[model samples]
Target: MVTWQNIDTVMLDMDGTLLDLHFDNHFWLEHVPLRFAEKNGLTLEQAKETLMKRYRKAEGTLDWYCVDYWTEQLGLDIEMLKQEVDHLIAVFPYVVDFLDAVRSKNKRIVLVTNAHGKALKIKMDRTRLGGHFDRLICSHDLGLPKEDLSFWGELQTIEPFSKQTTLFIDDSLPVLRSAHAYGIANLLAVIKPDSKAPAKDVGEFKAIQSFRQIIPA
Candidate 1:
């Protein structure tokens, strides 16, 4: 159980933590490939093979989350493509209640995400969860991805969180590790970021199946 008294800041991630990751997974893995195959006169398999190779090369970098980078690299209109399947964007179960619980406790709630500005705008508009956060920060503005240790210090400049009294939750182990290395006292992970996929093995960290499991007391 979390000791509510010690946690004054609740930092959260976007895609997999507050909202469903299935939309992003489908958009990148299936939707984008289908569009690429159709646009480039290649078979779907060929397109996927081509894109996946490029994606692997940029996986942990800021470029991996930049829509403009993907658009330029793939020669696709990523913003337009995201709209093509905006219907897939959705918030996870009990996320609103979880946010409300934080507000009720009067703790600072912030969203720190690596999602591109366009992508973040699209999801926030689609789900309308923007108002729940006290601050919404995108890594693009920081010039560093959360996987980098320096990102924590950069984030502190704007959000002013204390490592000892803040709780950071995310679906990515690398990001959690980044926070851990920065001396963040509380760290949590999500096991099933994409409801359609199997639970991930978040080694050496406490985890939850849903935000419901950690709703503020």
Candidate 2:
């Protein structure tokens, strides 16, 4: 059983955890490339391949999230492109129930995401998630990736926290592992990417298909 003792601070991932990731997947893997290709007069496949390479090479760095990076490479106003599909930004099923339960318990919920500031803003606007979190800590603002232990160290300087008394929930294994390495006592990995997926693996930290499983009823 996962204990919630002394867990005053709760850190959560946005995409795939609190929100549906299919939208982001579609945007990056399909929509954006198609739009870019059309705008640049390039083939869709060619545009996707080129953009994918640049993004992959930028992994773990701020440039990975920079709108300017994509704008320069794809020649599209990334922000405007985001606005085109803004309707897709949506909360996952059961996310609000979970958030409500946590709030009812009076826990200090903080949104800790590796998502870029601009993207975060876009998501918050769509989902109104900012109203739920005590603090929205973006990795980009800290100039470090959440998957790095040094980022946690820097976080400590900004806001002191006890790893042993905090709970962190994320969808990515690498990010979860990083949190564990940083000594966060309680970590929950959301399995199935989408909670609706059937017959998925039991998550690493008290595997859950829905947040309602962990948040006290």
Candidate 3:
């Protein structure tokens, strides 16, 4: 059976890894652009197309997560808008038990996400996942997305863990590819993100439906 027998450090993604992704999906796919359109007196399609294009242009950069960047581009107070839907933040199924299992085995649990400080704080405040982590590392804090090789360098400089023994779990395929290029020993992909959807593509890591599937009994 798959297990992390000798792993010393476990890195987790906050959004879809430890928390439910429906909230983020709904916020980005439904709420934000609609509100932006309303505030700017634009049609929904016009606002979504424009903002999505801008975000697409910033896909691999830190600007993608910057609320200030969105505020300047979309002409809306992104923070306040986020607060409007903040109650949607939720922990994923069996995540707390998985985290508890890892900690019970004395593994170092680190939260490695590409979320912005303000956004991360909103989720943390609402979900309490912060209390479970040994360190909360964000791409915004590193000034680069985790998909950049330079980000791994910055992560090592700050956290100082051996790549051969570190384990990381995330939902983004691109970010997982970046981690593989950096030689992380173990990687996991949250495959069945929606229990209701059919199987699609698996990322650079081993795909699993549940976090508990990988934890040793």
Candidate 4:
């Protein structure tokens, strides 16, 4: 549903857009809760309940995506924990072909993720997907989550692109809304972010089930 010739830059999210979200979903939902339960002397259900409440409180904030912040807050080495499950990191279907086609067409493909640097590096190292992008950015370095309007302006200061020619794809509706507000002309969402979970409801936005659907001409 995208007009390839009209798009100049292809900005993508990491966890849900370019990469399969199963790694992240399983990490937070199963792995962390299991470990937290063990450490805190609680049942898995209890740990999940407790952590979910805390996660909701931090949702959409930079702290939500901050490894250091979660490490300090949870009294856990969040980075180390992620490594224990790093083997699960994987790219989504047809992502490489999509990136190659876009690059071949000479469009600027950028990864704009909210993942902390450590988390970002771990996935990049594991998947060897770093070479596909023209630039990689973490909201932690920007000191604001993509959900914030200021993030767009701050992003432009460093990696400049015309808002009207940009195609921004993300699974997070809040972040997409912020991008829309910042005048990003083309927006798309992911139908299924977490492969193990049910598809997300992408209200009022166009979405893709696979990047294979939008490969550039």
Q: Top model by TM-score, which number? A: 1
Q: What shift in Å separates residue 173 of candidate 4 from its native position after superposition?
A: 0.6
Instruction: Evaluate model 2: give its lDDT.
Output: 0.80
Candidate 3 residue spans exceeding 4 A from truth = 194-200
Worst 10-residue lDDT window, candidate 3:
195-204
lDDT of 4 by residue, 1-217 (tens): 9998998999999998888889988998899899899999999999999999999999889998888998898888899999999988989999999999999989999999999999999999999999999999998888899999999999999899998889999999999999999999899999999888899999899999999999987
What is the lDDT for 98 in model 1? 93
Clashing pairs in 4: none
| TM-score, model 2 to reference | 0.91
Candidate 2 weakest ten by summed lDDT: 194-203
Clashes of 1: 0
lDDT of 1 by residue, 1-217 (tens): 5788999999999988888899999999999999999999999999999999999999999999999999999899999999999999989999999999989999999999999999999998899999999999999999999999999999889778889999989999999999999999999899999999999999889998888888877
Error of 2 at 102 (Å): 1.3
- TM-score each candidate: 0.98, 0.91, 0.93, 0.97
Candidates ranked by TM-score, best first? 1, 4, 3, 2
Task: Report backbone clashes per prediction.
Answer: 0, 0, 0, 0
Compared with the true structure, all predictions reach lDDT values of 0.93, 0.80, 0.82, 0.93
Best by lDDT: 1
* Candidate 3 TM-score versus the reference: 0.93
Residue pairs with colliding backbones in model 3 are none
